[model samples]
Target chain A: MITATPRKDLLLMGIFTLAVLTMPIWLAPIGASYPDLLQRFAIFGIFAIGFNILFGLTGYLSFGHAAFLGVGSYTAVWSFKLLSMSVVPAVIFGVITSGLFAVVIGYISLRRSGIYFSILTLAFAQMSYNLAYSVLTPITNGETGLQLSLNDPRALDSLVGVTPTSGIPPTNFFGIEMSGYSGFYFCAILMIIGFYISMRIFRSPFGMMLRAVKSNSNRMSYTGLNMRPYTLTAFVISGMYAGLAGSLMAVTDPLAGAERMQWTASGEVVLMTILGGVGTLIGPVIGAGVIKYFENIFSAINENVLHGIFDFLPEILQDGAVAVLSLFVGEGWHLTLGMLFMLIVVFLPGGMVEGFTRIYSRIRNKNNKNNGEAGSVGSAEVQPGE
Target chain B: MGILEVRDVNKSFGGLKALNKVELDVEEGSVHAIIGPNGAGKSTFLNCLVGLLIPDSGSVNFNGNSLLGIKPHEINQAGVSRVFQTPEIFSDLSLLDNVVIPTLASRDGAFKLNGWKRADQDSEIIVRAEHMLEDVGLIDKRNMHAGSLSRGDKRRLELAMCLVQNPKLLLLDEPTAGMSRADTNNTIDLLKRIGERGITKVIIEHDMHVVFSLADKVSVMAQGTVIAEGSPEGIKGDPRVQEAYLGGAHL
Candidate 1:
C-alpha cells in the first residue's frame, strides 16, 4: 500500500545517496566522523536493513541471523587466506556461503511459525556458535577465530604476484588500499547498494507476497498461494545481506571472530530494526546509526570525562552528579540502552519513524490552521457520513 | 459421480464423533446447501473437503481426484476454494489486494519467485481483480482496507476473492451467519448471480430463506449425521428433517 512509483523511487534513491555519501561531513558535528565508526554505521546499517526484510516485511522474527554474519566473515577471511587479497572475491564468497547456510537453516527452521520459528532459528545460531567455538575448531580456528595468515597459500595472489606491500598486507580493491577515508567510501557505496536493493524489495510483488504471509498465512494458503517458499526466499535474501555486511567488516579489518554469531549481536540488529521502525524502509538504518552512536559515546564517557563537563557546577554537586550518573555510562552503557528501548517500545509502538510522522503531521495541521484553511476545508477530520 | 464426492467420512475427537459416516455428492453446476444445527459437524465436514482436517477413515474426491492428506495449498491448487465462516481475507491489505491474491495464485501456480514486478503495476491482475469486484458490486470499495470494511462488506469482499479464482468447487461455511435482513437478501441476490456462472457450490447455512431461495438440493443433519437429503420442498416437508430441527420433539 505504501509502494512508490518509479519517479518517487528515483527521488528516494537520490536522497538516500546524498545522505549516505555526505555522512562524513554531516556526522562531524556529532563527533562521529572517524573512519572506523563511520564504517560500522554502513556495515551495521546493511545488517539491519537486511534483517528488516524478513522480520519487518514478513513478520518472521529470526533470533539467529548472526549465524549468517559469522559464516560470511569466516568465508571472507578464508578467501583472503587461500585465494587473493582483493575484497571482491572475499565479499562474493561471504554472500554465497551465507546464502547456502541460510538455505539449510531456513529449510529446517521455516517448518515452524511464531515463537517456535524464532526458537528454531535461535537454536540453529547457538549450534553454529558452539560449533565455531569448539567442535569445528580446526576449520573455524576455534576461540581465536579466523584470521589471515601470511604463510598460507594464496594461489590467485601468487599467480597475480600480489605480494605483501609492507610487513602486513592490507585488503585492497584492485591494489587500492582499503583504509581510512577510502575504506569509508567503499563501505558507503556498498551500503547504498544494499539500501537500494531493500527499497526495491519493499515495492516489489514478492514483497507484497511476504506481507500477505504476515497478514494471514492460512488465508494465503487457502487463496491458492503457497507462502512457504516466499518466506524462505525472504529469509535467504536477508541472510545474504547480513553476510554481505560481515564480508565488509572483514574487508576493512581482515579478521573473523566467533562472537559475531553470538546472540547479543543478533539481538542488537533486532533492537536496531525495532527502534528505528520495523516496517519502514529507512528506519532500520537510522536505528543502527543511533545505537552505534550511543554505544560509542556512552563507552567513551569515563568519570573524568563526566567531571570535565560537570565542572561548571559546584564542586560538591559535580562529584555527586558524576557518581550517580556513572552507572549509566562507560561500562554501564547497556543500562542506558535498555531504558531507551523500553521508553521507545512503550511510547512509540510504530518506532521512531512513526514518531517523526506524527510530529510532522501535527506541524502541518497547525500551519493549515494558521493559514485559515481549517474553516474552509476540514479534510483532516473524519466524518460519520454513513 | 458428482463433481465433489465425500464417502463414508468419519472423524472423531477423543470420545466425541464430530463427523460420523458423512456422505455428500455435490453435482456439477448445482447450488447444494447443507443445513444443520450447531454441533452437527457441518464445519468439520467442509474442513475435511478442503484438507484442513483429515477424517479418520474416509475418501474425498474432486473431479475423480482424491483430496486426502494433502496440504491446504494443494487442495486450493486442486481447484477447490473455501470461504471461511468468519471472513479470512487479509485484514491489513487493501480490498484490491484481498480480491487479487487468488488471481495471482491462479496465474502463478501454488508458489512463485516473482519478486521483480510490482503487484499494482500488473495490468492483467488489476483488470481481472477489478472485474471480480464489479461482479460483487464492490468496484468502488477496492482501495479501502479490507479490515476497515463493514461486516457485510467483508463477506462480499471475501466472496469476490473466492470467485476470482474461478474455483471448480466453491465451499462456503456459514456464508451468512449474522446479518441484517437487507444484507441477507443482498447476499441471496449475489449468490443468484454466482449460480448463473455454472460453478458448483456446497454451502453450509442455517437460514431456511436462503436455502429455499438458492439451493437446488438440501441436506439436513443432526448429531454429525445427515438425516434427510432431497429437494428444498421435500426436505422442508420431511418428518425426519423436522425432528432433527425440533430436537426429536414432534413439530
Candidate 2:
C-alpha cells in the first residue's frame, strides 16, 4: 500500500481536519492568525499537494505548474466579471479551463523525461507568462491584472434581479461573503477535500502504476502498462487542483495578475514540495506553511526588531548581534530560506518527512529498550517505504 | 508451423551489423537457447522480437499476426514478456507489488484508469502475485523492497514479475549471469518447473551447462549470424561451434 491502512488514514484525516479548522486559534501565538496569510496557507497547500501528485508519484518534475494556477486565477476573475459574484461558477470554470490547458501542455511535455521534460514545461510556462503579459492583453487584461468593474454586464446577477450597488459587490457563496474568516474557511474546506482526493489517489491501483513509472518506466512497458496516459491523467488532475487554488485566491481577493504565472512562482511550489517531503501525504502542506510563514513573517523582521530582541546585551554586543542577524531577516530572509533548503537537501534527502520519521522511530526504539523488549526492536522498527 | 516466425531479420548500427538475415522459428511449448560470444547479437535478436528495436528489414510473426511497428507494451499485451540481464525489477516497490503490477497489466491490457480501486486490497491480483512469489520461493520477504534483495533474489523477483503475467513467450537474457552454483541450480530447477506450464521460452546464455541442461534446441551464433543449430548433443559435436569458441588457423 502506498499509504497507511483505512483506519490509520481515517484517524490521520480526523487529526488533520481538527488541526486545520482550529488554525486561527493555534496559529495566534505565532502571529499568523490573520485571514490573508491563513488563506494563503490553505491555497498554497493545495497547490503544493497537486504538484506532489505529478512530481512525487511519477517523478516527472514539472516546472510549469504555476501556469495552471495563473490560468485558474484568470478564469475565476473572468467568471466574476462576466457571470456573477458567486464563488461556485468561478471555481468550476477555473478548474475546467486549467484542466484543458494541462491536457495540451502535459501531452507535449511528457514526450520527454528528466531534464528535458523539466525544460519543456519551463518553456511552456514562460510562453504563457509572456503571452498573458503582452499578446493576450484583451483576454488577460495585460500586466495591470484582471479585475471586476461596474460598467461590465453581469448577466447572471442581472437575471437574478440583483440591484446594482455603488461599490463593487463582494464575492460570496449564497448570502455569506467570501472575505475575512468566511473566505479562509472556504479555502480550508477545499484544501481538505483536495488532500483527501490525493490520499485516495496515493492508495489506488493507478497510484501504484504511477509509482512503478517512477521506479522503472522501462520495465513497466514490458509488464504491459502504458505510462503516458497515467502521467497525463495525473497532470490534468493536478492542474485542476492548481486551478482550484488559483480560484480561491480570486475569491478571497478578486484579482488575477500575470506575475502569478512567472517562473519564480512555479519554482516556489517546487521548493515547498521538496522541503516538506517529496512524496509524503502531509509533507507538502507543512512545507507550504513553513515557506509562506518565512515569506510573510520572517521577512517582516527588520533591523529595529532585531535591535529590540538584543536590547539586554551589552551595547557593542547588541549592535554586533543585530548587524550579523539582520542579514538573514528583512530583505535578506531569502538567505535563511536558502540555507534551510541546502541543509535539508544535504542531510535529509527525503525532506522534513524523513527527519520526522527518524525522530519518531528513534523515540520508539528508546521506548522499546526501556521496556526490555530489545529482542523485537529491530524487527519492529518501521521502514521508510512502509 | 512454429508459434513465432522470424524471416530475414536484419539490424545495423552505423558500420556494425548486429543481425544479418537472421531466420528462426520457435515451436510452441519448447525451450530455444541462443548461445554466443560477447558481441554475437543474441540480445539484439531478442530485442527485435519484443519491438524494443525494430528489425531493419524482416517480418516477426507471432500466432499468425505480425509483431512489427507495435509499442513494447502492446507487444507485451500480445503475450510476450522479457527478463533483462540486469534484473529490471521495480526496486522501490515491495516484492509483492513487483509481481502484482504485471498481473494487473495482463488483466487490464495496456492502459486502465483504475484510480478508484485500492491496490493493496485487490484480493484476486494479490493472491496471484503471492502465488508467483511463493513459486519463486520469495513469499517470506514479499513485503520487503525488491532493491534490498541480493542479486540472485532480484533475478528471482524479476522472473516472478514476468511469470505472473503468464506470457506465451518469455525472453530471458542470461538468467543466471551472476548466480552462485547453488543459485544457478535453483534457477535451472525453477525454469524446468515453469516449462511444465507450456510457456515458450527463448534464452540467451553464455554458460554451456545451463544451455545443455534446459534447452530443447540450441543455436550457436558467431559474427552476428547463426553458425549452427541442432539438438544440444549434436551442436556440441559440431566443428563450427568449436571454431566459434576457439579461434581457428589464425591462432
Clashes of 1: 0
Q: Encode model 2's per-residue lDDT on B1-251: one tens digit a residue.
A: 99899889899999999999888889999999999888999999999988899889989999999999999999999999999999999998888889999999999888888887788789999999999999999999887778889999999999999999999999999999999999999999999999999999999998888999999999888878888999999988788887886554221
- List runs of model 2 lying over 4 Å from the truth: A1-3, A375-386, B247-251
Native contact fraction, candidates in order: 0.63, 0.74
Clashing pairs in 1: none
TM-score of each: 0.95, 0.98
Candidate No. with top TM-score: 2
Q: Write the per-residue lDDT of candidate 2 for residues A343-378, one digit (tens) a residue.
A: 999999888988987787777767878998864435
**Deviation (Å) of A89 in candidate 2:** 0.4
**TM-score of candidate 1 against the unseen true structure:** 0.95
DockQ of each: 0.51, 0.69
Could you tell me the lDDT of residue B125 within candidate 1?
93
